[model samples]
Target chain A: MSKGNATKLLGAATLGLMVAALFMVFVYAPAEATQGDVQRIFYFHVPLAWVAFAAFAITAVAGLFYLWLGYPVFDQLAYAAAEAGVVFCTLVLVTGSLWARPIWGTWWTWDSRLTSTFILWLLYVGYLALRAALADGEQGARMGAVFGLVAAADVPVVVVSVRLWRTIHPAVLVTREGSHGLADARMVATLLVSMVAVTAVFGWLLALRVATLRAEARLRGLAAELLALERASEEN
Target chain B: MRAMAAVLLKDVVVELRGPMTTTALATVSLLVLVVLVFAFGPVWGQSEPTAAAGALWVALVVSGTLGGGRVVAVERERRCIDALVLSPLDRGGLFVAKSAAAFVFILVAEGFSLIVALLFFNLAADAALARTAAVLALGAVGFAGLVTLVGAVGGRAKGRDFLVPLLAVPLYVPALIAGVKASADALGGARLGEIALWLKVLLSCDAIFVAAGLLLFEQVVAGSE
Candidate 1:
């Protein structure tokens, strides 16, 4: 199949998987004993968090690869992934707060996970800002790649430090680990299927974003060539 | 190694030759401490150490932000950045030289700030004080490594005075949080082991930022766009 067709197929597959996931999340998975139905947000929230991490991992790896190989394409990949990562990270925070408000009786708390997530958001937002603040070509890309790699590499340290800084997380108040250890096979399957679905969606969004960037770069190149020709003709 | 040492030695010589950035920040640090003292409502109270810790870190961070980026700025202002870029020194070695030199200046300013903080706040001069000093040293290493690199890029921006702090502070949060906590623990008479986690954070941050500075120094110190 052609590349466009393949992309179309992937999108359709994501949609199908998402529909299946919605069924499993609502119909298949059993409600928790304590939190009841609001607990269902866990499936989406956790998967979104996972995708955020994965997206950032892609950004970091691509950034480092760009630095080593000096390829504009790698930098492009890193930038695209960072944009997607930031979007997913925002979803993670919003969904997490939503979940927290219903179950933890508060809209927000300075728990380690939440705080680390917030900082992760800040770092990437800073990454985007730094990218914008610099030259728009290879120089900016190079600087951004450096910042991306450094910031991503520092994430583990951030998590550890934040956790050490605050130990009283709401996780202690209520258990949300692996379906609350409910051991219900259907519930487990639902969580797994949902994770797969969102991950697929994440992939699709990443590809779309990258393709847009690539096209934009191509157009910019064409425009620059046209302008250069125009200037030469005028000078002659 | 020789190139790196030469770069460092040059900075020290240049600094010692004149008052430059350090002397200016010393005065600023003292003024900041006075403001902090007033805000904390007299530091000689029962909770002086607690207030003193905050004052100390803020002073250190402020002084650090002002002085950290200026070394590179002065180089740029004097067209020394171009010379340094053209030099035969390895970029990583240049990074090492710059960060090491920046760390020394930062240490001096921090020492002065610490004295100012202690005298004004009337902080205790016991074992806890020694521990806090150690925390300051460890934290400064990481802070210096980061600000040196950040300052290199940030000092080039049109709004560098703002940009340098904007770039440096986010990266400094982890170290600052850990350092402040550890300082509090020390001042509260907690044993070293009890504050081990905070110390670990500081150590890891220091190591990571130093290694990162070394690796990415090439990108930072590259020729103009």
Candidate 2:
């Protein structure tokens, strides 16, 4: 199948699953007696967090590939993944904060998870800023790739922050006992569906971003070639 | 290794002869004390001894971060970092040397800051307080190492002054929390074993950041250049 067709399929699947998940969340899934409607936010919030983590992980792996292989494509892929990860991570923070407001009685807390997420946001923002600051393309990509890998090393720090420090926020999804412990069968089914849907959306978004980057690169290369030819003609 | 030590010794001698960096660090420490005094005036007056320990530790961390954060920018602006990189010395060695220099600079600054805090806040002289200073030293070394590495990376970026703190502070949180808790316990006359967990956490963080900085220094320095 063509790239465009694959993107369309992914996009459709994402939309379909999103609709199904929403219906299941509101209608089929029972609302928590404790959190009530706010509990529903978990369906989207948790999946977005998962997608964000997956995106950063992919970016880091791609960065390692770029450094090892010296392939511009891998660098491009890493850049695209980092951008998507930042976006999703930002969404997770905003939605999580909003969800916390009524339940936790505050919009923000110094809980380990919240603090780690905030740090991750800063790391990626700095990553993008570093790229923007560089005048040389190769230099920018190499610098960003290095930073991407280094920043990815901090992921474990973020993951363990909750366990190491005292936090008011309970581990909702991925507990020490695993997801199987906290979530019942029906909740698990809904969560799994949501995760699949979110993953599809993430894939579609990354493909589009990668395609755009590739197109931009091609245009730049063509322009450089054209300039070289013009200079040769003038010399003749 | 000798070349790296030579560079480290050069930085130390420069700091000693001119003492500008050390003086600046001392000044920042004084400024931190003033801020803490003002912010926690009532608490400062009521619990001067206890507050002094906490304030001193904080001053040390902040001053150290600022000093270390400028290490690369100063070298780069002088075009010395390029020369250093071009030399036969290993990049990891350069990182170690810089971090060591930073650690010592911060220790001196913290020493001066502690004196200032004691003078002004009238903190009691106690064995526990002495041990707390030692713990602060360990914490400073770790903090300086991490910040120096980050500073080297951020120095080449735009808004580096802004970026360095943004990137460094979050990473330093765990260390800061652990260090502060350990120091607090020690200052309160608690046994070292009482704060053993926090001490272990600080040591682990120090090891991790040092290893990471050493391993990644070449890439960051070369790429930035």
Candidate 3:
């Protein structure tokens, strides 16, 4: 259907799924025997992290396409995805911190996964800062695309190296071994639903942001066209 | 191959004639080392080898950022990039040449930093020093590739000097981690076999950066009318 209808449908789906996911997290999923209520954060935390990674992946792919095809839409999509990715990534870190404070007795640790996630956040911030520094133009788009691709390429390496670094250096705090051993099926169901819910939420937000960016680009194009027309008329 | 060599030789000849970039790189790294010594001097007894390795890498990265951009920025200042772009040379070949030049500069700078670290940290000049140099060389390969491409990417932008570090630093994390660990192990009297995994990580990081630089450099520096 139309773009607006698709967005509305996405918004409705996201709202429904989010509400269901919340209910499942709070009322359906049973708490862990050891960690108690704080364990419940896993449902949201894992999904947020998943969506954040997915969003960044989308940004990289969009950037790749923009670089290859020189399409403005791809550039816009990349920018929007990067923006959404950063927001979700931040939420993942904040939620992780909140959970850590209660469960690990510290707000943060230099664990492998945690350290890589922080690096991922920094990569996103760096991408955004570069984009902000350069005004909207062909050069900026190309630069941003190149940066996104390079950043995405480094993710696996970052994960591997950080994990290696952590293993070599003795951990300051003891992390839960086998962190995701969902003994209860309800917990699985909740996690799966939460994943879908967060994905939908990300989709809705991405669509809205892309639409706004497209409109802005169009306005800029029209303004440039108007200036050209005025200049031509004055010369005549 | 000839075009790449020509570009590489041009950069080398220019730097050799007036070694401003190399001198600046060495000085910046030296200053960074001195600053690190002051900061970590009090805790020297805690982890001397680790502190030395960490300080050296920090200097490498900070100076690497400063030197990396000069490769492209110099060409830009002389308005030579456009001529080079218009030349018949392959863009990928050009990438190889520029990164190779950057590699040489960063290696020189790292070498100076190593000597300074030796003095500041009071580490013995022995086999461990040799191993540390080897690790620094590997780290420089990856860093040279990264900082070169990032420099070109940021070259056309406003405040690109700031953009270079902002974009390269995070991308350089894996290298930093692997480099620091390998160097620390080397300095701590560990065998090459012990830090083989980290060295492999550095090599892989180098491959990724160089390969990506080859693929993306054209788009990043494609001059527009």
Candidate 4:
């Protein structure tokens, strides 16, 4: 019923799902016939990528609302979502690198998806930096909103152009034998569970960050009111 | 349309009076090409077409960020942006005028850069050069639109000269990748039809940046923080 109870329930659910996901990934799912243990990172990697993209979408949508409605809350939501998105994006890059080094035989490749994801990471980092650089007020928020909207629009083009670029000059080291597909039902189930678990983690993290930002905004508003009241009382 | 043209004329007149933005763009682009020549092992015609194409684009991006932001930054010197915002001109028209001015400046700079690239990289001056020039022009359209939009905010902040490139470069990646590939193909004597896909990407990027700039420029310059 209460907000605190909802958050506690969310935490408990996230913990339970993470435990289930870990067990299913290591114990329930069978190893691949080819790539073996290294392939297991896909469970975490794919979900992290999914959640990061989703988080950025939230940031952009929230920014849109902030601009349209002129609300501080929406700006706070955008900032919180961007922070969480960056965390997940960083993990995606790391797990991807770990997987790539053993499999693709390189620490990094300019593959379309990898390159798009890297650019996405850079764009959001720029977003965060822009916010940090500007004055903390309506103007900063509006500028951030505009930037978020434009960055979101830029992403698909990035994906398409990078794909075209890579395909035009295919890398020599790509030894992929087949599609990255799961042929087994058990693997599918494990991936499904992992996806749900990671998403739950993201939801929980986003809520916590948003709440902290809201509270900070509220505190600043109250402090300003207090200062005004003190000044009035002193004059009286 | 008349208001947009008038604003554009104002920008052009100012630019021609001083020629600061165009001069900066041309000079910086040439310097970047010189740096790239050194970095890429200055082998003249022996170097691949891709290397030369890549170098030219790097020049465009580096100098475009430096000079394109100035297109709007120039408005901030005497608080001219506040006056413009309060003027009867439509915000979208303002965006279009600024971007168009940036587009022309970039084209001029690109012309200089391309000529230097031909000599520094030792490329032929035939149909291939024309095709490459066309490709660079299209790429400039998108870059100009983007830099103009970002310049509004990037110019207002502290340490803005650094801020402009920081904010624009990542968003410019798709255009950079597409432009370099298309130019390289053109330089390699490939027909225009062969690089249609890359050209399409550039066109799409141009459309999105222009559209986004039109829609968001109002909020970007609405008020002083």
Estimate the lDDT of model 1: 0.82
**What DockQ does each candidate score versus the true complex, computed on alpha carbons?**
0.53, 0.40, 0.76, 0.80
> What tens digits encode model 2's per-residue C-alpha lDDT throughout A54-128?
888888898888778888889888888889999999999998888878876678776667777877877888777
Model 1 chain B worst lDDT run, 10 consecutive residues: B151-160
Q: State which candidate, 3 or 4, has the greater TM-score.
A: 3
Per-residue lDDT of candidate 4, residues B36-135 (tens digit)? 8787664555546888898889989999999998878888887888888887888998999999999999999999998898898778889998999999
Over A43-162, each residue of candidate 1 has an lDDT whose tens digit, in order, gives: 898899999988889889998998899878898889988888899899999998898887777888877778889989888887777776776677777888888887887888888888
**C-alpha lDDT score of every prediction, in listed order:** 0.82, 0.78, 0.90, 0.89
Stretches > 4 Å off in candidate 4:
A175-180, A234-236, B42-48
Write candidate 3's Cα lDDT for B1-225 as tens digits.
898999999999999999989999999999999998888799789699999999999999999998877898899888899888887888899899999999999988988998888888889999998999999999999999999898888877778888889889889999999999999999999999999999999999999999999999888778632
Candidate 4 lDDT by residue in tens digits, A1-236: 98778988999999999999999999999998788988899899989999999999999999999999988989988998999999999999999999999888889987778888999999999888888888776788899999999999999998888877778786766635463579889999999999999999999998888788888878878999999999999999
Better of 2 and 3 by DockQ: 3
Docking outcome class, model 4: high
* Residue-by-residue lDDT tens digits, candidate 2, B1-225: 899888889889988798877888889899999998889877545555557767887787677767777666778988899888987889899999888888888888888887787677766677887888888888887787788888876777778777777667766766776777677677777888887877877886788778878887887788444
- Ten contiguous residues with the weakest lDDT in model 3 chain A: A171-180
Q: Model 4, DockQ value?
A: 0.80
